[model samples]
Structure formats: C-alpha cells, structure tokens
Target: MSVSQPYPQTYPQQGAPAPAPGYAPQPGYPPQGQMPGQGPGPMPGQMPGGQMPGQFQGQPPVQPPRTPTMAGAAERPNLLHALASESTKLWTTRSTLWLLICATLSMPVVDFAISSHYAGLDQVLRSQFTTDSSISALTALLLYVPLGVMVITTEYSSGMIRNIFTACPRRARVLTAKTLMLFVGTLVTTTLLSALSLFVSHAMLPGNFGEPVANSDVLTTAFRCGIYLTLATMFSYGLGAILKRSAPAILIMMAAIFVPFVVAVVTGAAPGSLGEKLMDYSLISGLLSQFNPQDAPATGPSATGILIYLAIAAAAAIGGAYALVLTRDT
Candidate 1:
C-alpha cells in the first residue's frame, strides 16, 4: 500500500497562526481556496470557477475581533512564566524526557566502564580513542533523533497539537517558541551527556583524548558539535509537525541517514566506481563527511555545514506543515 499523505484535507501557509475566533489575524488566514479580498463579498468565479463567496453562499461574514469589554490590554506573558511553561512542557510529557534522562546518565557510565580497556597504551589508545569517540558521538546523536522527533509528534498524536495551536494561535510564534525550548533542551541534554562522558573518561580512563590539541581547536569542535546536535534535534520538531506520525518520519529519517551506506555495501561487487560514487553523494556520507573534514577526525559537520543542512531539513518539513495547517479544515 502507498504511504498516505499527511494532509488529506486542507493546509495552511508559512508563518500563519492557527484559525482563531477573529481574535487575531493568522499568517495563513486566507487560504488560496479563498480568493484574497473577495471573501466578504462575491467573486467572479460564477464565470470562471463557479465558486461562490462565503457571504453569497449564506455563510457567516468574517467578523472583526471582539474588543475586551472589561479591561485594559492583556498583559504579556512574563519571562518567568514563559520559562516555567516551556520547561514544564519540555520535561513532563511522553518518552522524550525519559530517553533524554537515559542518554544523559548512560553515556558517562559506558565511557567510564570502557576506560580501562584502552588505558595505558597511549598510541593505540589515542588512535582508537579518536576514531571510536567520534563514532560514539554520532551514535549518540542517531539514537537521540527519535526522542527529539517525539517532542513534536507527541503533540499531534495526542491531539494536543491542536490545543497548542489554538492556545497560541500565532503558529509561527508558537513553533518558534517551541523550537527555542527544544534547542535549550537539547543543549542541556547534550551538555549533560558530554560532561558525564568527560567525567567518566577522566576518572576511568584519564588519558583518552591524546595529547590535547590547541585549546582553540578543542573548544571549537566541542562548541560546533553542541550546535550541530541541537539543530538536528530542533529539526525533528518541524519534521514531526509535517509528518504528524512518528513511524513514517522515523522511516524517512533512517533512510536519509543510513540508506546510502547500505546502497554502497549492496553494490560493492557490482562496480567499484559507481558504488563509491553513490556512497559519496549519499545522505549519510555527506552528513558525516562534514564532520571529518580533511581527515581531522570528528563527529559533526562544521558549524556552517550543519546550519545549511538543518535549514534544508527545516524548510522541507516546516514548509509542508504550514500548507496543511493554513488551508485544511481543523
């Protein structure tokens, strides 16, 4: 059977808010199906498309927002309340927090446990450490994607997305706020994991990373990795908003991340040139290659590369999302 489309009914536009009670004008307020400025009145579609306007069709006219009868302007959301709200929302629900907790605690424990195995032999250990640690970092990220995606998909799955959209109304603002929260969450989680890893490595292994490179390079790499992982996680929110279903997005994600390598392996004996070329352009290769630039040995794209890739991913997922949100019936 074919995969079902996410937007079977209607969709919205980018930056638009949710359909509200005339309280606010959303970005995707008027859908393409609704001809601009012709909604309150009749359209000439009686000659071309033959579709009548809302008023002509006896539908209720678009009413202006009701002014607050009792009070002054509504107070803005306070910073403390906003922070608490975002934090509570980020941590309370679903499996994501649990996954994060596990990741946060497990990395150090595992790394420390393995410290002894590679200790003492500095040369073999250094080469091994550099390669394995980079891969290990990526392994951490791939494992984290599902939980990150869940941060968004859970809203849709439980129908809370509609509630969220309704409450906030400004879809872009809501999404942006959510993204900010998620980014913060990822940084917190990644930092926790990184710290734990360091603690474990130092306490358990002590001399794992080799003769420390220039402080600048080390800090730069770490900073870049943090941002990479954070953006990757934020991207999942957009993906979930569009896909709505967790399973399909995960499937697509796996394909985007791993299928290229699989393709190369399967074609290994067919033609060396074609197989190698295919792998070179593969999503996994391209994504991972960014990190290992010039054979420096790392586990994340350059800050710039990650930013570009994240942008592309966000555009695809979020673009489809606004379309369905704006035009489709709730």
Candidate 2:
C-alpha cells in the first residue's frame, strides 16, 4: 500500500472558480448546517411569534353586515295602508268617477220625473208622489252594485290582485279595508243624493202636500235609504270577490236584486201569501221595508232584518274569498 500511492491532484488558483451563473444554492447538498426542506427552526405546532395554525397572524376574519332588506321585511301591513291603497285605486279609475256621477244624479232625476208626472194630481196624490220620489233614491242600488262589483273584479281582470296580495299577504284584512272604504264612500254619496232628492221633491210639491213632512217617517226613510245603498254595495262587493269575474258578478248581482220582484210580478202572486212571501225576502222589498210609514208594518224585512241579512251575506262572501285566495294559485 505505501509503495504505489496515487499522486495528489491540484486545482486552478482562482479558488473554486465561482459557481455557474443562474444556479441557485442547493439546500443541504453543499451546505452543512441546513436540512432538506427545512427553514430557520420554528418549534412543532408553532409559527413565527408563537402563532398556531389557522390563527390570524395580522388581521381578523372579515364578516358581512346585515342589509336593510336582509334584516327584515320593509314594513308591516295594516288596515290604514290597505285603505289608502284601495281609496287611491277607487278614485283614480274613470269608471268609478262616472258611476259615482251617475249615482249622484240618478235620485234627483228620477224624483223630478216622478214629480212632473203627478204635477196635476190632487194634494193627496201629490203627497204620495213626493213620498215615492224620496224613496226612489234606493234605485241607486242598481248603480251601486256595479260600482262595487267593478272595484274588486277589475283588479282580477288587470292582474293587480297579484301586486296587492304581494304587498299585503293578509287577504281578509284587504277585504275588510275595501269593504269599509266602499261603505263609507257609498254612504256619503247616497246620503247627499237622497237628501237632495227629498229637498227637490218637497220644493216642487203643492203647498197642500203639507210643509215637506219632516216627521219621524221622513227621517226614517232617509236614514234607511243610506243604509240600504251601503249594504247593497257591500253585497255586490262580496259577490264580486266570490265570483272573481266582472261580467258574472254583475249578472249575479242583477239577478239577486231584480229577479225576485220580476218573478212575483210575472206570476201575479197573492199579496199576503207565497207570492208576497217571496217578495218579502227580495232585496228590493227588504230595502223598501225601511221606508214603510210608522203607522204601517212593512210587508218585507224590517231595518234590523235587512242589516242582519246583508251582514251575513257579506261575511260569507268575504270568508269565501279569503279561503280561495289562500288556496288558489296566482
């Protein structure tokens, strides 16, 4: 082994000759202190500054804030809002205005016509004519029915009911609001028209018709006229809601109001028997009962009876409408 040792090799004096350009210093290959894939020592389960894994090193996690729409519904619905919405719709429509005008004008026009017809009659006949003319204000019910029918039916026809229900999901409340508004509107208009007709009829009456007759009878008739118009309007509204169509609702209302009397007339039913009984329950008869003189009992329903019947009908209609609204598709 000592006899033939290999000669020692020598390198250029430029000393390691600088590493090749663009070469990165390899980790742990040529270096002695560093290990493969290891950086400056960080103890197990600990990062720099003693931070644990998933801990925010510099800033906290961001959170989204609640928006107005996300936080809650915009507002709670109530009767007042419903009333405003309905009243706006009621007044804005051309048909409403026209119907109201017709309703307002009808009583006076009919009274005038009737008065003119009986102008040459005796004082007793003229007084009777005046009384009939005042009661004729109830005829406005024909117009009132259509007005009420259109109020709700038009919404269905135009698809506004979807928007209405979307805004106010309580269907019963919506119906109640509409009913209240319609009642008040119809009452005011009917009352004024009825009063105007009474005034005109009295003014035109011969002096022998006896100083306009401002007794309990006259007051009762006037009050009943307003009540009748209001109730009739609600009745039609209920029918409209139940039917949900304008033409059918109007036709049904007409039949309900007019058909009984028409049938009785066509058949010439006896005054105090079955024919009279049918007439008694007819809508027109119920309304006219309110105008019966204090000395005479009504052949039809009393005022209280009329109110009860109308109330029941309206309730049934509204209840049915509400049920249908909840169960049916838009």
Q: What is the C-alpha RMSD of each candidate to the true structure, in Å?
A: 25.2, 10.7
Tens digit of per-residue lDDT, candidate 1, span 73-176:
76665444445666788788758778777656555556655666666667556344323344445666676677768877777788887886676666656665
By summed lDDT, the worst window of 10 consecutive residues in model 2 runs over: 289-298
Candidate 1 wrongly placed segments (more than 4 Å)? 1-84, 120-122, 195-214, 269-274, 281-291, 296-307
> What lDDT score goes with residue 296 in model 2?
26
Per-residue lDDT of 220-324 in model 2, one digit per residue for the tens?
A: 566777877887888788788878898999998899878888888777768787667777688877766665534222576666777788878877876777788
In terms of TM-score, how similar is model 1 to the real structure? 0.63
How does each model score on TM-score? 0.63, 0.72
